[model samples]
Target: MAVGVSGDDLMVRVGPDATDEVLGRPGARIFDMTGRPIRGWVVVAGSAVTEDEALGEWIDEGHAFAASLPPK
Candidate 1:
């Protein structure tokens, strides 16, 4: 639920609160497989995540958001 991969892109579940902010980041975009974008989810370009720290930060954001949700 936190992180995924679509082709070379990195998918992250950052939740609604951080969606806007994350979208402004380099190579970040709304995850839009359907006609409309899926809120709280983002696709980060592989180029932007070439560094280990950058990749970790995004995954951490996703983990934080997922952790905030109520248990299933």
Candidate 2:
């Protein structure tokens, strides 16, 4: 994983072929460098997909990115 910081947003770069099983954790918006949203990027952390059914369908397709806070 590669991380870049742009102002107040955290830019993340994960493996291109990453699967849902690898990035099924919730955080914030998932999009590409071009600013296009990628569906299935907001999967629930655990098996509680039903609670967020819409987000559960997020597949780790294409390059994915998200905003994150710097480690404290």
Candidate 3:
């Protein structure tokens, strides 16, 4: 899990266990809120993956994914 200031108005929180991983190797998946990957074509071919970070690209990806999920 990771947390940091996104900007003057937002604080981004990224957690590996935040989302669900549907693809990739064991324990290597795209997360949502339950540390799992999404059901989409976003997962790449490799087992390694990366996401957004505090107002950056990675952060954007994480935010979008988070928003798509239902409140849990």
Q: Which candidate is the best by TM-score?
A: 1
Better of 2 and 3 by lDDT: 2
TM-score for each predicted model, relative to the true structure: 0.95, 0.31, 0.27
39 Cα displacement, candidate 2 (Å)? 11
Total colliding residue pairs, candidate 3: 20
RMSD in angstroms, candidate 3?
10.4
Q: Rank the models by lDDT, top first.
A: 1, 2, 3
Which tens-of-lDDT digit does each residue in 1-72 have in candidate 1? 899999999999999888999999999999998889999999999999999999999999999999999999
lDDT scores of the candidates, listed in order: 0.94, 0.39, 0.37
Sort the predicted structures by TM-score, highest score first: 1, 2, 3
For TM-score, candidate 1 versus 3, the one ahead is: 1
Q: What lDDT is obtained when candidate 1 is compared to the true structure?
A: 0.94
RMSD of each: 0.7, 10.8, 10.4
lDDT of 2 by residue, 1-72 (tens): 244444444334443444344454454345444567554332222332335452323322222333232545
Q: What TM-score would you give candidate 2 relative to the actual structure?
A: 0.31
TM-score of candidate 3 on Cα atoms, chains taken together: 0.27
